[model samples]
Target chain A: MTASSFAFEPWANTHQQRIEQVLSGVLPTDELLPERLHSAMRYAVLGGGKRVRALLCYAAAKLVGTDIIAADTPAAAVELIHAFSLVHDDMPCMDNDDLRRGKPSCHKQFDDATALLVGDALQSLAFEQIAASQAPQALIQVQVLAQATGSRGMCGGQSIDLQSTGQHLSLAALETMHQYKTGALIRAATMLGAYSAASTDHALLMTLDQYSRNMGLAFQVVDDILDATADTQTLGKTAGKDQAQDKSTYVSLLGITEARTLVRKLHDDTMQLLSSYDQAADPLRGIASFICERSF
Target chain B: MTASSFAFEPWANTHQQRIEQVLSGVLPTDELLPERLHSAMRYAVLGGGKRVRALLCYAAAKLVGTDIIAADTPAAAVELIHAFSLVHDDMPCMDNDDLRRGKPSCHKQFDDATALLVGDALQSLAFEQIAASQAPQALIQVQVLAQATGSRGMCGGQSIDLQSTGQHLSLAALETMHQYKTGALIRAATMLGAYSAASTDHALLMTLDQYSRNMGLAFQVVDDILDATADTQTLGKTAGKDQAQDKSTYVSLLGITEARTLVRKLHDDTMQLLSSYDQAADPLRGIASFICERSF
Candidate 1:
């Protein structure tokens, strides 16, 4: 089937609205921060984007029959991590991108100094919000978020990406980088949703973890493909910028056709794992399909 | 007693050594991180000053009769926060000092980009280490550390300080900035130490909080004095840098004599608060005295 034949099911617009509300609620309201830092943070986070992390979290919680509101901390936490990464990634020393999500990057719209602090503040805020959360599962959720975003996770992945630039890497090296950088938090998003439901079944947690691993890798493979195929207008940011930087990507290493095939295989594998559960797993099934098929 | 006549007790050499050992143990092995990021982190963290924060954690834990080994996470966590702050504060947009603790600041030693990531990675690692800690008291310790280092704590204080630069700030505003910026972590150190000993008494925590608050401000007042009076060699970096930047400082705002008087009052008040705790609180007592009398 052609890509256009797949109907893009946007999962839970309500979840995105709720996450935006919570993010606005938790950010610093004090007047002490200059308008610049505040603006940079809001620009990075509140700017419209596909809130896929929050959606994944909400979808997973729903799959386990939990109230989606219970997933607020995890939802907000993932977005904060994502926002922080973007702020830093756009700095002149990193990707040096002048635009993001159809607007100026944090460092471009604001000064680099303000962008740096905004990233730092948002990151600290993410953990603080989780720790201060009143949810019954606050402590466990905080632990999950911290581990997923810290060294051996997101930051570790960034480190690998930074060092691997301009060098050829083995598939294993690339996968390891993605696992730490992207897969860790994606997996945490699913696990957080399950834990938000207060699920205690070890078996179910294990299966969701495996499903998340496949889906996370598949998500990155599709990202590489879109970078190759999408336009600036469609992608909402500069496309093919990755190639401009000579950075190694799944498409660069494996070719577009192979990357697409791998994503399909991973998508099928994830679906097979989710099949173990009954109707309670419907949301998970929907999210997996949405992730593979979504544009931009 | 005259400031010169007051005998200053040094940190217990063994306690200092133990903290050093713990810090070395918890940092990512050189092999795991990119050489640039890892080297910068090591240079910033191990390029030590007094290790006062770690000592405070160890001393507080000891006062409550908790094993020093159990204090490792809090000790490492506080140092990480301290290190990250120094790295950012030394950047071009902030205090902009090229040297820190008698060595080149991370940004000066490496490139600014690497320094930024080092600070970022260290901050993440701090939280990661606390969450992954195996100590029985890990959960409470993590909560305390997270709150202390987050917004409404250190980050918030920094935001205020940044905004207050070159602007005339009231004595109360100045106090508020120092309280948030420096006091939050200092208080966290004491609380972490107390909590490390498994003493969860609200009243005791309150008393230590009061003690730490006073001591933290007093420490900053002394820092202001040193900036005005000491030479670069003695101060181990640029002296009078604050006045040069026209940054709001206790000594600059209140004059040297008034700043000295405030430090003395804060020191006395801190000691009076700690009098109820007995010999176990000796480390705190010594630290309070040291704050008012230190030459640099």
Candidate 2:
């Protein structure tokens, strides 16, 4: 497909459905033993969210000329990690939000204990998905996923977020927190997809990583903008939560107009990083545009 | 070392220290950024417990004649999983206990949010440890640990336990709960260790697994006995909390005498499973005996 003709909307929609199906097949069926936990796991994961991580993974894999099928496991695995993080973050002890993706959060849909187990099991299932892959790169993939999810990455970012609640954070500190909490997994998504190829040069990996960083931060900036300006219905989650909880965010640090300006810069940087590649890079470029421009 | 000449006491002590060292080195230091979370992760894992899982892993690796060094990652990984489970299981939403390993549980030591993140981070760290292994079996090792930890394994068992609370369960049901809640990880410890070898036959894996099953059940029975008979000091946690919470246990169902009798039978069966192996299996034999006979 030519770069000009390649469309992000159809590609994203197709893969969103694709990952939902893959995740549905991978999660334990609700009919099995521990039926409640199984049901809650499926409930937490199998439904609604933008599969941004999975799309990024597939785009990066395609850019590296690997069979896109090789991207499936990492794509699904990153989505599982994302799902688990959201489930835990919504618990009473954390963000204490009641709405998520237009449904009651996992803890509200199930009990707190079940939600806890759902998050734990989903995390394990993510690794299980990655480990099931037969590629020679699978070992490194596990390492990458784990590193992104662990104390120094997503969880660490979360710790800072929890601590910073009700307290203002400097712009640098906020960015650092976002780097660990969200950027780590976002970067891993792209890196994992690229690694699906037989050989990915260090330079290419670094370029994709820089692009992913820009996109990850931009994604969060847009989220802050939406939380500030969108209604709960449009956001599919409680709006104005960051302000209500006194949590620091991009829009809080910089006004809405500034946050929008920052997103544009990030989008431009993301595009520049992919300029060396051909039409296969179109999906990534398209994703960057979508992230910065989307209303919710 | 010849099986007859090997001494369980010294072997156990030496390996226990080795694992403690390995875990300490692997866990992020408390002095780092997000220091509290890192500190909590270290506190939840290091300087406590018998390292029973690690010992089982090393023993099984010894039996299979792999370079014992190859066993370290899996050994530490299993212990990390065990620590994470305990941390979460102690939460008010779950077990609601304040004491664990004789110290305040993770939630009590830190706040509930930190405790939750500690559990999540440690679980990720466990996979990271396994992924860091250079062995060809590392991919399978990740799969084994994830399967043992997820819905079909430890978390699934915990889910059953949560659902069964304050309700009497049949002997078969209770056994099934313990099998998933505890048996799966114990079995994984041995299996992971065995997998460290260059090649392990399916039959040998089954034999080791059977042996592990007997040991795992016996370990839980002994735990129930200790919970009933031992002091908080001896057990290093709240004593009799199971009965206080109206949770079902082998001791609760079988009476002390019958439970003791079951332990004896399980110990004997474990020994029989190891009969074909010579002295290299002595550690496994010793561990099984310890599980059934220890007072606390």
Give a tens-digit lDDT track for model 2, residues A115-230: 99999999999999889887768888888989999988999999988888889999999999999999999999998998888778888888888988998899889988998999
lDDT values, one for every candidate:
0.77, 0.90
Candidate 1 residue A259 C-alpha distance from true site, Å: 1.2
Best by lDDT: 2
Docking class of 2: high
Name the lDDT value of residue B252 in candidate 1.
Answer: 79
How would you encode candidate 2's per-residue C-alpha lDDT over B52-139 as one tens digit per residue?
9999999999988988788888899999999999999999999988998889999999999999999999999999988887687888
Off by over 4 Å in 2: A1-3, B1-5
Global CA lDDT computed for model 1: 0.77
What DockQ values do the models have? 0.44, 0.84
Chain B TM, every candidate = 0.92, 0.96
